[model samples]
Target: MTENMNDQLDASATFSIELTCPIGLENVLENELHELGLTNTRLGEAQVKLTCDLRGIYLACLWSRVATRVMLPLTHFNMDSADDLYQGVKSIEWSDHLSVHSTIAIDCHGTNKEIRNTQFGALKTKDAIADYFVEKSGQRPNVEKQQPDVRIAVRVKREKVTVSLDLSGDSLHKRGYRQQGGMAPLKENLAAGMLLRAGWSKNSQFSQLVDPMCGSGTFLVEAALISLNIAPGLRRQYWGFKGWKQHDHRLWQQLQDFAKNERVSVDDLTVTFQGTDREQKAIAAARENIKRAGLTGIVEVSLSAFQEHDFSWQGSTPLVIVNPPYGERLGDEMALISLYSQLGYWVTENALGGVCALLTSNDQLARQVPIRPEKHTRILNGGLECRFYLFPVVEGSIKRGDRQQAVMSQGAQMFANRLQKNVKKFKKWLAADKVSCYRVYDADMPEYAVAIDMYDDWAHVQEYQAPKSVDEEKARVRLMEIVTAIPSALNIPETNVVVKHRQRQSGKQQYEKVATSQHEMIVQEHGCDFIVNLKDYLDTGLFLDHRPVRKYIQDNANGVRFLNLFCYTASASVHAGQGGARSTLSVDMSNTYVDWARRNIELNEFSDRDHGVVRADCFEWLRKSTNEFDFIFMDPPTFSNSKKMSNVLDIQRDHVELIDLAMARLSDGGQLVFSNNYRRFVLDSELSERYVVKDITAQTLDPDFQRNNRIHQCWVFQKRG
Candidate 1:
């Protein structure tokens, strides 16, 4: 009888099968296999190995929503070369698996030193299959790429070759009904996994599922498919085993009929699903996919914005699950925080006891929602670390209060006392100098390593970088306490305090934006008006430490032509204009800041005067200028490689050339004020020899900054006439 190979298709035929899924989904995939009756399931890296009968394999291919592929092992052998691979594969009975007329395709992965290219291995395997069929029947099957009748998967790892038949032609996530994928579409299986994680099932207690911001209806469609017991694979027209000679048509037909009988009518289902979007195009795509799945009557899609979603449900309030678009820029997230807060408010007002799950990549923006998440499940979505946050609303919520207490650790009280003491110490200087912005506290306490600068009534607190040896939780507590206690000590509102992470910064890093609240306030310093963007950048436009230097410029600028180089937002120019300089010119490389300088000049009515702002690199602008200045305030960055500059500026290496250029532009007996934050900066010997140099950095420190004179260095170079 030759023990006919056709018997492997029988109900009891057991074979080694492998189910593959994306990383972090192995446990979920294993659980799915267990539900499908796969025996002896063992989890591997991104794969699950199990023993299943032919019927079990069929069921797995037809029902697995999370698996990428179902593979039936054909043969495995030790191999070190392409010839060994061909010989190993040729031994398999090609006639038993494929007919001469059927086409085949090989997908090869992994490699050794000798076979580094996957295509080379695939070609060798394909040659072996074709040669075996030709040797048996004098004709070989043709190789087809798109929708091949038989798909062979080959993996070469650690000098061993594994060859198998891919039972699913394409990745199982491509459930053919997904005809319209919106921007950044979540894969169908991933959507199903999300729903499963959300505890949605045939016996779910929740009566309705609503995706108010649903894009393309993947989540709603997956929910509908799960409730209706419709096999997602049934939408596809072909299976890898259907063309094989060993396939049992009658058994597959029976399995199909069983799956068909398991399908429940939409009217008889306990759960209902609805998807909505503000974009009509997205809604149209959802309808197309729903129609393709033949669930047009079961699932509903509509054009509605989150704002337009009124609490107009018929029965119970649905669990609101949403995936909002997070823009791909720094300041872009600022706008979405209000939108998320609106979402939280909507869920709280409409569904008091219901659940809301939000998926966000930014924790800062999540905090703005004002609804504290009880559960934060970490998931890797397309390699971006994401959190599926679950929040439950209740009356008189105190969970957030508990979280605040927990976050503010034992050192909170000690940090608060340190801030109060610093406020008392700096109180006299703040009023005596008429200073609205000054560093009141700079690391006064060891536990709270933060610097607090006051801009009018607003407090800008910068948390210094903690050491690696310090406990992260302890450091977090210190930061929380510093932010929490600053407003109380300063008599300012909590919202008026701006907190930012402080590290050693230079060049454009200082200009990198943090938030976009546009909380600009005009603060007075020495009777000069300067606009401060407290929420936008690491630095406000006004530098509190440089108060004395700006004061020096203001006190000596009468009837003088003042030049402000590297004029970042032109705070120094504003001081010059306030000091009544006869004419003023401000030059900077950033067009954004040059425009800002223009705005500050307009604020003080300096624009109608002789003062003007120029957008140009100071280095290039100084070289071409024919005008000489009586007072030139040159404050170049430590180093910058901005694309706006033709040459990279390294203050230490280029200070000689920079000094020479500035000295050449100085009028007779004119003083060119050069300053930098480089702690170890040295005055150029040639410039000191050619001109009179006075180190004014010591005298440039205001009473508030007298403790840290190294914050900036100032040297006055006057032309020797």
Candidate 2:
């Protein structure tokens, strides 16, 4: 058998081979096969087909890093039923490929109407092989699943079936280095693919490689092996060809010896590796994996967070790569935004003139990174779709500390000039009124459509949604320009700016918390104290546009019972309490806003007996209450379909009904104030005839909101005598 096998594997004999890999890795696998000297190649979905001799096949199994399996084709036929499948598999000369003494297993994939499923197909193929051996030699090979001596692969695509021998006994991703893996650990071949995509090579200019979130040290070990020219499968103990009639043992041994000789010594390696993880257990696992891969001294790991990790190693242009938690299996996504931001900041500060690559499954989290990646590719890791972002840093560019002095584009400089002028105009009023928060710009330039609000030293930049007619790439570039100009124009730190996309929101979206950072602070407006959170929600606790309306309520609140409806965070209620109102009642349906209102009341040191915050739908509460109040303020959302509400509220459609409900509980001599931010609201004509109505929209506009008169509309109503 051995002599015959050797003769069959001569220089003129070649076989058609197919290498299968994970989805999105076909191109990488093809490149690896090319490096292994397999020339006649064709690419398919998640696979590469090639023509190579037996020595070439053995060489690929030993050196192809990104291929999951190396398979040698045996036969191809059409099968419409189970019997056809059995006969097709049996028709292959089984004795030439396998002996009765060898143990075999069948790995099947796909199915058809007749095959039904993969398990049934595998079972039928196994029986066919067993019956063939029995009929030929009067004996059958035993079936082995775990450690099969000869593994046959049977794939059915509708009526078409292709059978091959899995030359790789086990998946090539099991590089034999990782005894255990951490949560959602990246497969070794996938890691190698990512490195290739990021342009990491032995002959590349990068002098060092680092993985800050190095779970089990997969990236570090793979990087070292690739740079050292060590064959990935050199340490693997078994192969499916071990018992095959055609496997040339002497030729395989010669290939292994040549691969061993090609490997570079640790001392001669040009690139260095470093890794760190916040979890001690992960560091421990990475240490074990590094040692197992024979890279104890060459690669090092320590217990530290990515931010505090020592990136000060002496080298030419270091490469920083990380696979941070994507918030899928670990924790809440809102909190992970800060983590990505910090990682981005670290890279911008430390990785000058090098490269930074990050792998994440969340798109929202990916945007939190301050710098925009030049290239991003879609890939899959452990069945979850992910994006691999690559950012190349040029020296003396993109350092966060130097962002203020960085050169700006022509349009961005114009935006900065306009912002500075607006700040200068507001300086006197802001100082005299002691207002710590106010809007500085409301899309003054048509090209740059964004609103800039200043809360002391911090800037809240909201970009209005661009029209569909506009190019998305152009809009994105303009928004980036606006954000980049704000910090330098306002003389504030870049980290103090938060950017959000703004569009028309319906239902409870306006009140929903988008992030868990909870970056809140207190600001004073007209001698009234209030708590404002700028990050968690769409609208901050205090609406700067309503400053004049709240002031009017406070001045007239003296010696009156004040009724505050739809009181979000109760900022107006706080002002009324400070104005010595006899008592104040605030109502809202959301529990989150209700709790926030109570905290604002407490912040003002108001007595609980005199100040009240109720969590109830204003419409329902008004219908149930018979009590009358002398002073009332109603501010309803433009549109809400909140589940807690008894009915959807559209201010434009339901304003008449809502006003009547509030008026039923209003005292005869009391003044009722109604306000809405809807730009196109028209009051009912019949209400003007029933009660005296006055439009106070013009009077309610403060200096900061004078440019946009339609920011809000206000009206006062009183019962006719």
- lDDT per residue (tens digit) for residues 1-721 in model 1: 0112333445667777889876666777787778877757999977899887778878888888888888877777888767888888888877778898999999999999867899999999999998998898999999899888899999999788888889887889999998887777778887777676676766666778888788899888988888888887877787888877657788888888888888887678877787679878788888998898888878887788766756345455466788887645532443344455556666766656667777778875566455667777676677777777777666544234432232333565566667677778877887787777888887866667777888877777777888899997677645655664555556775446667777877566666777666878888878778788887888788778788899899989888899999998888888887888998999998876887888888888876459988888888987999988899998888889887888989999999888888878888978888999888987777777888999898888876677777889999989776
Evaluate candidate 2 by giving its C-alpha RMSD to the native, one decimal: 6.7
Q: Per-residue lDDT tens digits of candidate 2, residues 1-721?
A: 0011223444587878899887777888888788777878999988999888888889889998888899887888888779988988877778888889999999999989999989999999999998998899899999999988899999899888888899998898988989877766889988988887788876758888989889889999999989998899999998988888888999999999999999988878878889888777788889999889999998988899767766646565888888988864211443355466667767777777788888899876676566667788787887888998887776433434444333356787889899999989989998887887899999999888888888888888777888899997688667766765777789876556777777898878878887777888988888888888877777778888999889999999998899999999999998898888999999999888999999999999998798999999999999999988989999899999999998999999999988898888888889899999999999999889888899999999878899999999999999887
Residue 499 displacement in candidate 2 (angstroms): 4.8
Residue 121 of model 1 has an lDDT of 92
**Clash pairs of candidate 2?**
none
What's the distance in Å from true for residue 187, model 1? 3.7
